[model samples]
Target: MNRIPYANAVGAIMYTMTCTRPDVAYALGVTSRYQADPGEEHWKVVKTILKYLRRTKDQFLIYGDSDLKIEGYTDASFASDKDDSKSISGYVFTLNGGAVSSKSSKQATVADSVTEAEYIAASEAAKEAVWMKKFISELSVVPSIEESVPLLCDNTGAIAQAKEARSHQKSKHGLRRYHLIRALLNVETSEFKRLMERKMQQIHSLKHLVSKSLHETLDLGNINSIPNTDDYLWTHGAISDETLSLERTVCNDSTYMRLTVRGRRSQGCDYVFSRVSDEIGADVEHDDLLLPKCLSSSSAQFRPLGLHGKIHAAIARRANIGDPCLPERIFTYLNRPDVQKALHANTTHLPYLWHSCSGPLQYQQDNLDLNIIPLVLDILKEGIPILLFSGDQDSLIPLTQTRTIANILAKDAKLLTMDKYGPWYDGKQVGGWSQSFGEERDGKNVTSLTYATVRGAAHEVPFSSPSQALTLFLSFLKGSALPRPHA
Candidate 1:
C-alpha cells in the first residue's frame, strides 16, 4: 500500500475519532503508529476500522437537550504495545448524557506498573476536565461558574495521588504538570464567611435552584424502608429533649388542634386544587406523578378532617394507639371513581394505580452506600456551596446523625467553622440550632457550607415546622446565615 493513501485514510479516521466516534480512538491510535512505514498489518487494521464504521454507519453521537454538566472517565492499558513497551491512555468526557470529548494515545513515557499507567491516564483526563470546565463556564448557554468536572478512575492509587499534596518517592518521576489537579482543589477557609461567592453559588445550585433540586428533595427513603406510618415509627419514641423542653412552655390542645387542622386543610386544598388543575391541563402537559399527587392530596383531606377521620379516631380509641391504617384506607378511597370526580382528578386516565409511591421502590442493599464525600469534594472544587438541615423532632434520621455527617464533611473538605453550633432565631424565638462553615478572619465571613435543625419539626421538616422551615429555606436561598438573636 502507498504511504500517502494510508496516511490520508488514518487522518480522516482520526478526525472522526477526535470528534464523535470515541470507540474507534484506540484503533486509530494503533493504526497511526506505523504511518511512516506502510505494512500489510497496519493496512489490515485500518481496513478493519473502516469496515466497522461502514457496518455501523447509522450510529451517531447523541447530545441530549439536558442541562450542561461535565463528567469524565479514564482508563489505561498497561504496556499494551509490545513493540515500544508503552501504555495506552484513554479518556472520554460527557456533557449531560452524551460524549463531547475523548482521546486515546500511547503514553509519552513508559510506565513501570499498571498503577502508574492508570495514574497518568487519570492525570490526562483531569487536564481535559479542567479545560472543559473552563470552556463550559465561558459558554453563554451555560452557567458562568467553575463547577468541578468529575474525573473518574477505577484505580484507587490515582485517586489518592490526585488528592495528595505531598509528593511520594514512588511517584517523584511523575511529571509535575500532572499534579495540577491537587492544586486546583482545596476546601480550606479560616472562617465561615470567607468562602468565595462562586463557592456559594455552587452550593446554591446543589440544593435550591438547580434542575435536580426536585429530585433531591423527594428521595424519602431507600429499599430498606417501607412507606408512610412505618417510616415514622421513630417519631413515637420517648419524646426528644427538644420536644420535652417545648412541652412546658407551648402545650395547648386547642392550639395544637387548630394548627393541625389548618395545616392539613391548607395542604389538602393545595393538593386537591393542584390535582384538579393538573387534570384540566393534562392535554397540554403530562407527568408520571399526577395520579399519585391526586391520590395523596385527596388522602390528606381525609387524614384529620374527612371520611377517614372517624375511622382513625375509632382505631385510636380501640387500640389506645395512634392510627397506622389510615394510609391503607386512604389509598382504597382515592381509587374510587366518585372520589376522583369529586377531586377533579386524573383526567388523563393513567394506566397505573393512584398510589403515593411507585413500585420498584426497593433498592439493593449494595446500592445503599450513601457516602457523599467525593460528591461534596466534586461540587466544592467547582466552587459550590452545600447546605444540610434536619428537623429537630425527627428520630428516624435524627439531628445527631445529620450533624455528625455535616461535621465530617466539613472536616474532610477542610472547611473552617464559621460559626460554632448555636441557636438561630425565628421571630424572637429559637427556631433551630445551626453551624456555618467557610473561611473567616477579622470578623469578615465568606460562608460555604451551612447546617441547621428546625426546632419542633418532624422527619418532614416543612410539614412539622412550616414557619421555621420557611425561614431556613429563605436564608439558604439568600446565601445568608440563619438569623441570630439580639444579645
Candidate 2:
C-alpha cells in the first residue's frame, strides 16, 4: 500500500471529498480501508476515482441566502465490503442557504441484514442531526428544533426497523448502545420518514426545476455578458452644439448677471433699446427734476420709486431716435410679476435640500451598496420567500451539510407533506414536500421553504434536467402551483 503512492492518492481523494464528492464519501471510506494493504487492484480503483474527479473538476457548490427551510437526506450502503462486510453510512445537512457539514464512514460493527445496517446508519446520521440542531439553536440563527426535522431514508425496511423497537429481535447483531435515535424520537429530537427511491428522482427533478428557475429569475446566464449599447443613442444624443453653446455662456459669466436683458448682450454691438411713453397724469415741465429732490428727501419711503426714476432717466438718455424695430412689449414683459417670480425661483439659494445631509449621504452611498447581507437577513426574519440551493454533486460544499445546517436553523419550520404528482419510470410516482414560516402569524412576513433533490446529477441541476427543473423553479418563484409530473 505504501509502495502505491497511498498518500498522494488519498490527498487527491480528500481534495475531492472536501470540494465536490459527497457521493464518493462511501467509496472513499471503503478505499481508505485498503490503504494499509499492498494491492494492484486498490491502485486501479483509486486511479479510476481520480479520473472521475478530473472529469467533474468544474462542479463547484454555490450557497446563497434564501428562505429558511430545513430538509435533508440520509443514505447508507449495507454489507458492501468483501473484506470486512461492513456497511458505509452517509448523511448531509444544509442551512440558511448552503451545505455546512456531512460525513461518510464505515460502520463500526458487522450486521446480519441490510435493514439492520441501515438502521445503524440512520442512527449515526440522527446523532449528527441532533447535534447540528442544538448548535444552530445556540447560534440564535434557526428558530427552534423542538419539532421534528424530516430525515429522508430510501430504505423502507430500514425506516420501519428504526421506528419500531420490536423489529430488533430479528437482527443477529445486538443494537449498538449508542443507537439512541428511538429515544431521541420519543422526546422529539428529530423525525425520520421512509422515502421511496422514486421520490429521490422527484427531488432531483425539483432541483433541476429550481436551478433553472433561478437562472431565469436572476438571468445569471447573461449577467456577465457584454451589454448592448444600441439603445444608448438617446443618452449620447444629449450632447449637442446648442447645449454646448449654452453651457459655455453660463460658464463664462462671473455673477451671471451679464445674461440679463438690461446688460450688454454682446461687446461693442450697440443694439440698445428702450421704451418712452407719454402718459396723461398730473405733471409740470419741471416734474422730472423735482422728482429726484422729493425721492432724495424721502429716500427710505420712496426707495421703490427711486430706482424706477433712475431707470426712466437712463431710458430717456439712451433711446434710439427712430428705431421702429424696438418693441414696447419687451419692457412690459420684463416688469411682469410672473417674470420676476420666475427669476427669484431660479436663483440657487432656494430651499434645495440635497446639500443639507451631504455627509451622511456620501457615507451611505459608498457603504450601503455592499451591505445587502444584513438587509437580506432582516427580510428573512420578516418571513419573505427566500430559497437557497446546493447540488449534492457540488464540490465546494456538500449538499448533505447544507441540508443538515438548514434543519438546524429552521427546526421549528412547518413541513409540507410530500404528495405524489405522477409516475416516472417503472410506475414510480415522483413528488416531494415543502414547508414555510412567518406566513400566517400576525405582523410576520411570509416565506415559503422548499428543498428538492436532483437524481444522478453532480452539481448543476439545470444542466442535468432542464425542462423539469425549470418548470418547478418558475412555479416556486412565481408562487404558482408546481406542475404535476406526467403519469
Candidate 3:
C-alpha cells in the first residue's frame, strides 16, 4: 500500500547492480522507473527479482591464479523503455574469466539508430576500461601487457564509428561525449599503435581517392589575384565560368567594407541584392518581413487574383494542426489533483500553468558532416562481425539509405558479397530482403557485415514488429546467418 519502502528496496538492489551483479541490472533498471508511483505490477516484478537473488546468494567469483588478462564485453537493448524511449547499456570487465567490474545504465540520450545506441554503450564501457587499466597498473602487472584491452561489441557499425575519425551525418546527432572514445582509443594506450597505423594508412588512401574523384568529375580553376594590403579594393578576379568577380571594397571608414554581388533577373529587371558588411561596427539593414506590409507590397508588384483571401484562409487553417482534441484532454488530465499526487509532480506552483515541453533546451549542431563509412571500414579491417538492419516503414531513415551505406562500406572494406540480394525469412513467411559480405579464412567464411530489413516495421522496429525483431536479434547473438527458406 505504501510507496516509500519501494524506493528504499530498489535503492538497495541498485547497489548490487552497480558493484557485482550485472545479470540483475536490466530488471532493476526496469523496476526503478516506477519508483515514484509503484503499481501492483511493479512491486510484483521487484519481488520476483528478490526471490531470484535469494536463490543465487551462494554464488561467488573464484578467480584462477593464471590467465589474468583484462577483457571487456558490451551489449545494448535499444529503446527498451517505452515511457522514456532510452536504450539500456550493459558492460562487464573480467579478470581470469570472472567479472571484476560491471554496470547497467539507461543511455543519457535518445539514439536515432541501433548503431548509435551500440556506439554509445561501447564508449561508456571504454571509459570504465580506461579507469580499470589505470587502477590495475598500480595494483598488478596489466601495464606490462603489449596488447590493447579487447572490447567486444556485437554491432559492426558502432565498432567502425569508434575507429574512424570522420563525423557522419547519421551519427552527428549523437552526444559529443560518445565520440571521446575515439580520442581515447588513440592516446590512452600504446598497445593500439597497430590500429593507429592502419587508420592513418586508410586515411591517406581515402584522400587519394577523393582527390582523384574530384579532379575527374569537376572543372578545375586557378586563382588569378593576390592580396595587396595597400589597395582600397580587394579582388579575387573571376574564377572559372563565374560571371561575377568577388570583390571587397573599403568604405569611407577603414574599418567598414561592402561586398557586392549579382542577383537573379525577373521580367527583364535585376532584383536588388543584399549586401554583406565586413566590419563589426557596420549597420545592417533589415528586410520588410511584417506579414501585412509584405503581403500588400507583393500585391503591388505582379500578383495573382484571390491571393489575399487565399493567404488569410491558409493562415487561419494552419493554427489548427495536429490532433485538436488531444491538447485539451491532456490539459484537463494534468490539472487533476489526484493524478498530480499519484505522479508526485507539481510540488511547486509557478506563475504559469503546467506545460508539456517548456524546458529550456538548446541543441548545438556540431557534427553535421560526420560520415561513419570510414569507421565501418576500420571495423571491417579488424574482422569484427556487424549487422545493420532497418524497418521498411521508417521513412525518416529509409531502408534504401541503409542498404546503400552498407554496400559502400563493403566496397571500401574490399569485402566480397557472400550472397546476392534476396528475400530472407522468419517462420516460413517473408521477413525482408538481405545480403551478406565478408572474407574466407581458415576454411570458414568469416562474415564481417550483414544487412537486412524488417518488413512492416517503423523507426523503432521492436515496438512495431516484436516477433520479427526477436528472431533477427537471436540470429545476431548466435553468430549464425538469418534463416533461409526451404527449397
Candidate 4:
C-alpha cells in the first residue's frame, strides 16, 4: 500500500495550498491523513486533487479589490471524520478580498457539541488573528490592522458563550476543547497549538447537575391508537395533518445518554408522566420479567415482596444479569441511605434526589394492535433525523425486532440506501454494523435515518459498550456517513 509516491504528491499539493490556493486546504488536510499507509483509494484522492489543480491552473489569487480591512472567517465540521470523531476546524484570514493566511486541520480534542466545535475553531482562529494583526500592523501595509479584527462566526451559541458567563459556567465538561480563559473568555493570543485533545473522553454519567432538582414531570398528550390519535393511524390514511411534538432531553449536561423523552399528540397536546425502565415494549420481555399467571401459585413466594419490589427486582437485574456479583452490587446500591431517601417504593412526588421514577405494580401497556411505523414515517417526513440502534445481546427489544422496524420505516419513507450494511469503527476496533437510508437533497445524499447494532452490548448499549455507543452517537449527530469496514 505504501509503495506509491503518495507522500510526494501530497507535498506538492500542500505547497500549492500554501502558496496561493486556499480552497484546496480542506481536501489536502483530509488526504494527508492516509499518507503513511496510502492505499489505492487514498492514491485516487491524490490524483483527483492533482486533476483539480490542473483544471484551475490559470486562476490566481488577486488582492486589493476590497478595503484594507482583514476579514477572519472560522468554521468547523463537527465530528466530520468517522474514524476518530475529531472535528475539522478551518480558518482563513483574508485581506483586500484575497486570502493571506489559511489553515485546515483536525481539532486536537473532540467537541461535545456543534457549538463547542465552533467555539474551538474560533478559539484557534483568534490565534491566527492575533498573529496577523501584529504582522500587518508592523508592516504598516494595511490601515486598521491594529484594531479589533472582524472575525465572523455563524454559531450564536458560541457568541453567547463568550458574552454570557452563565453559558460558560454551565458548559464545564469539555473545557479542554478550547482555552476558555484565553479565547472564549474573549481574546487572541500566542502561537496556535494543534494538540487539541482528539480522543473521545469517557462519558461522565454522574455529574453535579445544575437543573436544581433530580426529577420534573409535565402533562403530556395521547399515545398512538388512542381515541384522539386514531385519525392519524395507518387505516385512516398515510398522511398526518399535524406534526407530533417530540422533545428529547436536552444535552445540556453529560447525561444526554440517559434518554428521558416526552412526546405529545398534536391533537390534544396531552401526555402521561411515567418513567419507563428499560423498554416497556413486549419485545424485551423475558420469563423473569413477566409476573406469575396467578397470585395463588406465586402469592406465598411474592407475598412479602410487594409489587414495586418485584418490578424493581426483575427490571434492575436485566442490566447485568449475567454477572453473579451484580445482584449484590445492586442490593448494596439500592439499600444505600442516600438512595432510599430519594426512592421509597412510591413515586408520586417531587423534590427527589433520585434520577428517575417508574410506574406502579400494575400499569396500562400500549395496545398491541397499534402500528407505530406510520407515526415514525410522519416524523421522518418532517425532516427530523431518527437513529435506531440495538444491542445484539439484548433480549428485551431484541436486535432483530428493531432492525425490522428500521427496514419498515425506510421502506415506508421510500428512502434510498446511502450505505449498505457494513461495520463501523471506534478507533481501530470494530464497533458495530450499520446502514444508512436517506433521500437526496440538492445533489447530496442526506442521511435522515440510520440503523445500527452494537456488538456485545446489552439493552442499554452505553452501559455495556460505551465506546461503541459514543461512536454511533457522534456519527448520528454529525450527519456523517458511517465508515465502511474495509476503509
Candidate 5:
C-alpha cells in the first residue's frame, strides 16, 4: 500500500539524490528495498533521516563554470550489515562536473575479503560509467567526452587489480566476473584518445571566444536585449517632470520669495558695510584700551588704536567703498546664540566627544555604532567579494579601525596600500591604502585609501580640496585605478 508518509519520504530521498547527498544514495536505496514491507523500525529510521536532512538543509553543492571532466569514486564498508555478513558498496560519478550519479547498497553476495568487496564495488561503478558515457553521447548539444574518466578507488589493491589483468587467478569467480571492465577498457582506449584531442581543441577554441557563457547560465540576451531607449525615456522623463514641478514650487513658495528678497536687500545695503567698518574700529580700540598698564608701562602713553585708525582711514579713503556686506552677515550668523547651541549639540554627539567627556550614554551609543564587520562576515560566507576604502585623514573612522575590521573579517583577504594619484593630487605627494579578500585573490578586491593635507586643510578634507574629492569619488564608482602622486 502506498501511504502519504511513505510518498513524502520517497520525495525527500529523490530531492537529496538530486542535490548534494550522493553519499546517501546507497542508504536510501537500501532502505527503499524494505519500502514494500511494512515495519515500525523502518519508520523510525526514516524519521532519523528526516532529522539529518533538517540539520544540513542549508548546505548545497556549488557548481562552478568549468569544463566537464568525468571523475568518479568507489568505496565499500567491510561486513557492515550484521544480518547478511556483506559489505555495503557505494560509488559516485561527477561531470563538468559535480556529482551527477551515485548509488549505495549492500552487496548481492557476501565477500571473503575486503579487497574482493571493493573490486565488486568498482565493477558496479564501471557499469554505471559505461551507461553514463552512452547517455552523454545521446544528448544533442553535450560536449564530447574525450578524456579517460578517472575512477578513484581508495584501496591500492583494487587499483592494482583493475590495472593488472594477470593479477587475478582463474579460480577467483567474483574477480573473474569483474574482469569484464578490463576488456571494456581495452576497447575504449582509442575512444579515450579521441576525447583527449577534443578537450584540447575545446580549450583552444574557448581562448578566442569572448562570448562564452559565464556562471550558472545567465540569460544575458534577456537582460541586454531590453531597449536602453526605454530606460532613458522612463528615467529622464520622470526627472524632467520632477525638475519642472520643483522649479514651479520654488517660484510660488512665499518663504523662498522672501529669502530671495532678503538676500538682494542685504547685498544692496551700503549701511551694512558702514556697520562692519564701525565694528572693526570698535574692536581695535577696545583691545588697545583693555591692555594692562604694567605691560604698556615701558612704552610711551601713545594710543595704538589711534595710530591704526589713521592707517585704516587712509586705506578706506583709497578704496572709496567700505568693506562688503557679506562679511557683516557672516559675523552676524556666527555670533547668533541659537546657531552656536546647535553646533555644540551636533559636535557633542560625535564618538570622539563621547570618549573625551566619558559620557555613559554617549559611550553606549558609540559601542552600538553600525560596524560593518558582521555584514562583511555574512557576505564572505555567501562567497561575495567586498571592498573597503578609507582615508588616513578621516577623523570620523580612522585607517586603524578599518584595518582592524578587515583583519577580523577574513585572513585570506588581500590588503593593498596605494599612493594617491591622478586628479586626487594637490601638487604634493598624497595617497590612500586598501584591503580585499576572496577566491579570485586578484587585485579586484584591492581598496585604495588616500589622504590629502591641503596647505591648510582641516577635518573636512573634501570641502578643503574639491578637485581631489571629485577624483576619489569617480575612481570608486568606475573601478579605475587612481594615479599615484610622486613623492
Candidate 6:
C-alpha cells in the first residue's frame, strides 16, 4: 500500500469529482480518509474508483432545456461511518435541471436519530439556498427570486422541527454567523449581462487642493542606485514610467536610471529616462512652440509631463515591469516633432526633450499636510459603498500601506468587520486577498466598505492584471463583496 502512491491517486480523483462527477463525491470522500495511511484494501478501492472513472469518462452533464428555477435536495445517512458513528450529510442544488452545486461530507457532530441527521443536511442546504438567492438577484433575470426558495427532503418530522427554532434535547445544532462565502460568477466578456450592471453611470470626483507645506517624510533607508548590478533592472523586469516619475518626484532622482525598450511592433528602440530627457537618439526638428511672450525672461512656462503615481505620500514598492515599451511608445507617438509643431507652432522654449516645444503645464512644489481621514469618515457617514483596491506589487502605493490605511479608516468610521481576511477568486484560481468592513443591521451583512489586494499586479492595476482587475471592479459595481474561495 505504501508503494502504490495512494494519496496521489486519490488527489487525482478529487479534480474529476469536483468539476464533473458529483457521483464520485461520496466514494471519494470515503476513500480520502485513508490517504494518510492507506492499507492494501484501500489501494484496491482507489484503483476500482479510477477504473470506474475511466469507463464513465465520456459521460457529460446536459443542460439548457429545463426552466431556470433553482431546486435543492438534501439527505443524510445516520451513523454512516463505522469508525466514529458519524452521520454523512449531503446536498445537491439544481438549476436548468442540472446539478449546479453539490456537496458530500461528514457532519461536525453525530446525530442520534434519522430526523436529526436529515435536519443537519437541510441546514447546510439552507445556507446554500440563501447564497443562490442572492446570486440569482445579482443576475437580475429571474423576476420571482425574491420569494423564498423551496428545499425538498424526505423526512416530514425534520421539516416540522426545523420550522420550530427552539432547541430541544434531541436537536442540538446552532446557526453560524457570517455570510456564505461561495459565489460562482462568470467573469468572461461573453456573459457580461449575467454578472454586471448594464446601465450607464456618471461619476463626479471631488478635487482637493494641495497645501504648500510638505510634511510627508521620504524613507530612503533601503533605496539606492543599481550602478552595476542586476538587482533592480533584472529582478523586476524594468522600471516603469510611473515608477520613474515616482523616483524623480519622491526620491529626488538620486537613483539615476534609464530604460531602453524596443516595442515588438516597432523596428527602433523606445527611449525612457527617469529624469528630464536630454534629447538623444529620438529625431527632433526645430519648432517655435516654446517662444515665451517675453523672450528675454528665463522663467520656465512649460510643465514636464503627467504621471499619476507622483503622489507625495505613497510608499515605494517593487514590482516586475510587464509591458515595458507601451508607455515609452505612447509618449514617443504623442511627442513627434511634426506632431509638436502642428500642436503649438508659434512659440518655443529651451525644451529639447521628446517635446521639442514646451507644454502649457509647469511643475508644482506645494505639498499638503491636511488630514483627509476625516473626509473619508464623512463619506462613510453618507453610507455609500467604497472599494479601495491596491496592487500587491505597486511601486507607488503598496498593499501593506493601503491595508494599514484601510484598517485605520474602518476603525475611525466605527464599521464592523463583515468579511474577514481571505482569498477571493477570479474563476477557480485565487485572484487576490480581501477583507470587508461594513455596517450590519437586521442580521444581514451590508458591505459598504471593502479593501482588496490584487496579487502580482503593478501600480497601474488594470494595465498589469487585467483579468483580476476586471473581476474586482465588476464585483464592486454589482454591490457584491469580492467572491471568496469555497470552503
- TM-score per model over all chains: 0.37, 0.36, 0.36, 0.36, 0.36, 0.34
Q: lDDT (CA) for every model shown?
A: 0.57, 0.46, 0.57, 0.57, 0.46, 0.55
Candidate 1 lDDT score at position 128? 76
Question: Candidate 4 — which residues are off by over 4 angstroms?
Answer: 1-3, 167-487
Question: On residues 70-133, what C-alpha lDDT tens digit does candidate 5 reach at each position?
Answer: 7666778788789989887877666644467767667887877788788777788888878877
Candidate 4 local lDDT, 158-263, one digit each (tens): 6665554544542544355455525523554322222234321111111111111211110111122122221212122321222211111111100111112222
lDDT of 3 by residue, 1-487 (tens): 4834788889988897677655566577668889888988888777767765654443334344454577777777789779999997777777656577777678888877788888888888888888877778778665434456777776778878888866666455444678878887787441221222222111112113212332132211100111111121122111111111221221111111111111111211111111212321122111101111122233243222122222221121112222212323455578787888789877785556665435654322233223455566777788788899986644334565577667767877788898778888889888888899989899888778999998765545664566788889898889888888867
On a 0 to 100 scale, what is the lDDT of residue 295 in model 5? 15
Model 5's C-alpha root-mean-square deviation from the true structure amounts to: 28.2
Q: Which regions of candidate 1 deviate over 4 angstroms? A: 2-4, 170-172, 187-487
Candidate 2 lDDT for residue 222: 20
Q: Give lDDT for model 4.
A: 0.57
lDDT tens string, model 2, 282-392? 221111222222223332432323223322321221112222111222344554557757876324444432221243443232221132333444555666655544433
CA displacement after TM-score superposition, residue 141 of candidate 3 (Å): 6.0
- Model 4 residue 74 CA deviation (Å) reads 1.7
